[model samples]
Target: MPQLLMIEDDARLAQMVGEYLEQSGFVLTHATDGKAGLALLEAPTAAGLPDLVLLDLMLPDMDGLEVCRRLRALPSDAARLPVVMLTAKGDPMDRIIGLEMGADDYLPKPFEPRELLARIRAVLRRRGEAAPSARIMRFGSLEIDRDARTVTVAGEAREITSYQFDLLAALAERAGRVLTRDQIMEAVRGRELEAFDRSIDVHMGRIRAAIEADPKNPKRILTVRGVGYVFARQQD
Candidate 1:
């Protein structure tokens, strides 16, 4: 499953959101403060670090922004981990600060649970675990021209939406890796949006229908059971 660590001081909100997400097929690990949250990440398992982080700006030990900055400063590959700032402070300044500090997305307090889910999905989509675009990306019969925003299927050029292009580019870039929905959204939207209002799966479904010869039994893009999605490099 896609493991997520939530660092929030409000126990009630954490429990409510945890239960809600648990029902949605996500594994929820809790950290009551920023310190513990940072600890858990510092010691990740072979399964890899938590796929995403739902962080609150206020913590008992340290400010959430400081925690985010410190994490980003880490030298390991873990620096790429995406964090979503969830806080009651709806100030635009807070949102901007969070993003500027390396947060992938920011969700304000008194927000809808559905919106949270959307943001999570968007974050995963954007973080698609692919290599840098400087690396050539190929998946089965599809070849992506990252710099050109063009796709060649079976060696022929085909038109696709900008969003679709981004989605496919992300998956192809990752190729063999499993990318969570939150990662996908983060990669696709980059650092611009405050909320991911759209569902990543729906976009993936649309992309599949267009590219997969058999959408019902997709080959290029495959769902990685409870984790998220993976774009197989080979169709067979």
Candidate 2:
């Protein structure tokens, strides 16, 4: 009985989705707008916060992108909660922006319930994955603890979305190897890249923001011009 929170303004769509998701053994808590959704997440009971969030891009109180930004700014671990964004907008830019805002996945409107379920499961799977080995890779002040699924810089913890962590791990695991976007996506077991390959770049930027001392001139993750990117084995 995984708990889920959905922040959507459409009553009919929420009801329909709730029913379908419940049938798949998930318990859903519905919030009609962004404020209510944020409130629920900000203050949780002893049972704790929802396992994941299904956030809609359009809300009555505030836009979903803004909501997502607020959610990521949360002080607690709730900031790392897996988020799957839903939007009617067909523009890939919206989806790209959502990823930049820390969303774990994105789904367009008029989508099949099955696809939605699959995406939710896929995101949850990634969130739940812990490295089989308790190996912590250290590069200068940066540290990637695969067993704990946490990243730290100079002993200070950094926040990164689950998807971005996987992307970073994918590069770090193959340190010094240049991997193209397609190869990186494959290594991450990502199935959500649709119509936009630059999504990888968006995620890389976010990862850099978290772990790099200066994201503007990243020394850890370097670009290979027309090729892909490689993680520098030596960092200053």
Candidate 3:
């Protein structure tokens, strides 16, 4: 059973979600405020940390975006932790901001319980696949060590969320191939791309920022206009 930490302020909704997730075989730890959630995340416990976090954008004490920013600033292991933001806001900008802040995924409010469960499962599944591997890939100044699950650019470590790393790895592994949005989502998360889903584009931008010497003129992951994106077989 995967453990999940949900940082949500609405007591009633939290309870309902907790119950639903519990029935789906997840062990949920609920925190009503950002402070409490941060405290739990920072303090090492005998039980170990939760596998994933379901963070709400609206919190009582602090904005969820601030909480996410702080969370990503933590030391190695904690900083790479996967986060999925829950928000009532339907605006695309809000979702884009959450992704820009390092959220692995996001779910809008009024979503069905099943959809939440599916998202949780997908995120967990992707995280589980990050164990060290024996292969290492090199692209000019960029190096991806599968055995370490780490990437370095120009021999220097680059900062990227685990989710973004996975996304990059997926593309690099299939370099020279143009993968559609659906293909990328299915390959990374074992899920179909939702209609008008721009999360992948946001994540790709972040990946470029970390690895490309000049993100504005990226030479690694290139867009195919209406088709999708492809990782360059050759890089500078």
- Candidate 3 residue-wise lDDT, 33-87, digit = tens: 9999988778733334677889999998998999999999976356777999999
- Taking the tens digit of each residue's C-alpha lDDT, what string does model 2 give over 149-192? 99999999999988888889988876655677887888877545
Give the top-scoring candidate (lDDT).
2
For model 3, where is the 10-residue window of minimal lDDT? 188-197
Ranking by lDDT: 2, 3, 1
- Candidate 1 local lDDT, 54-153, one digit each (tens): 9999898998999899889876545778899988777899889999999999888888989999899888888774533564466667778877878877
Q: What is the lDDT of residue 105 in candidate 3?
A: 99
| Residue 179 miss distance in model 2 (angstroms) | 43
Query: What TM-score does prediction 3 earn?
Result: 0.56
Each prediction's Cα lDDT score? 0.79, 0.86, 0.83
The candidate with the higher lDDT, 1 or 2, is: 2
Model 1 weakest 10-residue run by lDDT: 190-199
Candidate 1: residue 96 Cα off by (Å): 1.0
Two-way lDDT contest, 1 vs 3, winner: 3
Residue 84: error of model 2 in Å?
Answer: 0.2
